[model samples]
Target: MAAQQSQGIQTLLEAEKEAAKIVQQARQYRVQKLKDARSEASKEIEEYKKAKEQEFKAFEASHAGTTSTTQAALDKETDAKLKEIEALFQSKKKDVVNTLLQRATQVQPELNRNLKKLQA
Candidate 1:
């Protein structure tokens, strides 16, 4: 009777070990599935973003020739260009002022360093 009881206990331990192994495998599978799902979701989100960007680009291209919005955009762009031109003039304003001053004073001001460098 004691030997039979020991055998039963051994069998129970073996069964428990197998159950534990199955549980561990199930946990691993669940983790892998979750990772796969998250990766898929991330890929889908990126695809959605790309699709939205393309749609927006298409809409913008289609509307670029429309009168109302196009004119406003053109006006804004024109203003930007004008501002750039104004900035360029401002940047060269000192040179222009110096040249004008020398002409008015009838004195040859020192030659421009940049011009001398360029000539050399």
Candidate 2:
């Protein structure tokens, strides 16, 4: 019937409008959250970096040799520790990546389940 077809179109149009509104609102919320997260992350990073630099400068100043002997001793120890940390990081980085990949593989089934539920 002509009337039925018109009514179906009207219903479909209204459903589309509602879906559009929901999608627009969700997009706006996501944009706001992303901006807020970025701002917070930048602020925290700036504070941390500033604090670390200040700490290092203070330490260097306090240790500011009345003598070259103390300065050389500090420099040597710092260099050795830094090299040790770098080697440790190089060895562990591959293990960290492998662990992440293994975890992702384990979660594949759960991800599929969630996708199925969302589609249903």
TM-score of each: 0.56, 0.51
Worst window of 10 by summed lDDT in candidate 1: 61-70
Error of 1 at 107 (Å): 64
Q: Write the per-residue lDDT of candidate 1 for residues 37-106, one digit (tens) a residue.
A: 9999999999999999999999988887796877999999999999999999999999999999988999
Q: What are the runs in model 2 whose C-alpha is more than 4 Å off?
A: 66-120
Q: How many backbone clashes does candidate 1 have?
A: 0
Q: Kindly give the number of clashing pairs for every candidate.
A: 0, 0
Candidate lDDT (C-alpha), each: 0.96, 0.93
**Candidate that would win on lDDT:** 1
How much does candidate 1 score in TM-score? 0.56
In model 2, the clashing pairs are none
Candidate 2 to truth, TM: 0.51
Cα lDDT, model 2, residue 90: 100
**Top candidate, metric TM-score:** 1
